[model samples]
Target: MGAEAILEKIRKNAEEEAAALAKQGEEKAEAAAGKIRADAEAEAAAILGNARQRAEELEKRERLMAGLQIRKNTLAARRAVMDEAFSLAGEQLADLPKERWEALITRLLLEAAETGAEIMEVPAADREKYEWTPEGNLPIIGEKSFFKRLNAALKESGREGKLTLADAPANVTGGFRLMGPVYDVDASFDALLSQAREDWEQEIYRILYPKDE
Candidate 1:
């Protein structure tokens, strides 16, 4: 073949090879771009899912916190009401008539009396208020008051005991302390009511909070 023709054929073959390589390179680049796009979409979907899950968790936590606060408030309100009820009870007892109080004192003394000798400790206020009488119907000591009658009542109630008023007063509100050589009895209103407060709490709650019913 002629040199010119041979050179032209060589140039055409070189051009075709270059074109094929260019097309292959373009196809590889496009495939790489498509893979990158798919990866980015997957990453975005994962991020979105995590954000949604976090939001749901936060909402659930907030709801739980709100519920706990509500319960705490309800308990506080209930406690306040119970405290007021107890305050009213104290007031009512303090407001009792003198006659009723004497009768109550007599009953308490009678209940506390036992065979043999016993001593009664009353509040300082009661000491100034009531008088004491020795054995048998006598003139009396201190003032004309409940303690005088108390001894007679104890004897009549079949308690074979000498009830003597203590020199020192008791630290009590409404009831007295009965002391014997064997054992002592505390009939203070604070003590007796405190012991039964737990047993009575539920009943008091039911009476005050009947909204559930």
Candidate 2:
């Protein structure tokens, strides 16, 4: 329910507890002898004071809890928005047009290439999409072929066009990974987005929540 409703419920409960304490004090004061009644009256006053203090504490505690709940909810909502922002970015990457997608992937592949002879491992679906023929062989020399573009990029980058495709597909999408002799460079969409998230999270948050609200 709403915070107001919760607060109102807590208010009623505290008031009821205070009323019960006041009634008990009244009963003790009424059943005492004259002198004893004076002592009982004083004790009753102390009891009422305690009840007021306890009620105030209960209100404070409830308010604190309500405040915490609100903060938790706000943070959860903000996180949801942040997650959606990243998800949309990934979706945009996935939905890139063929030529555009190839160009983007080619750029990443070129940048990630160290020796230019690394095995390019892409997902099986990507292999079919790029028409990667038997054992890393390019189907034909054409601008449409992604493999030929890789060789062109490698040559342009002052490296041998010895880059070959892995026989087995990589568990990746939107990009490929370079398996070098000593290391590997992941250029998959997941990896790219993950890194981008880490690097640009604060910047994106600033744009999303201008006041940091």
Model 1 clash number: 0
Q: How do the residues 47-159 of candidate 1 rate in per-residue lDDT, one tens digit apiece?
A: 99999999999999999999999999999999998778777776676667877877777777777767636988888776744664333254345334466567667778887
Candidate 1 clash pair list: none
- Top-lDDT candidate index: 2
Q: List model 2 lDDT by residue over 114-204, tens digit each.
A: 8888888888877765655435466543454668668878988898878887889998766888899888998999999999989998888
Give candidate 1 regions above 4 Å deviation: 1-32, 110-116, 132-145, 156-158
lDDT of each: 0.78, 0.84
C-alpha TM-score for every candidate: 0.72, 0.70
Off by over 4 Å in 2: 1-42, 132-144
- lDDT at 166, model 1: 90
Q: Return the lDDT, model 2, position 97.
A: 85
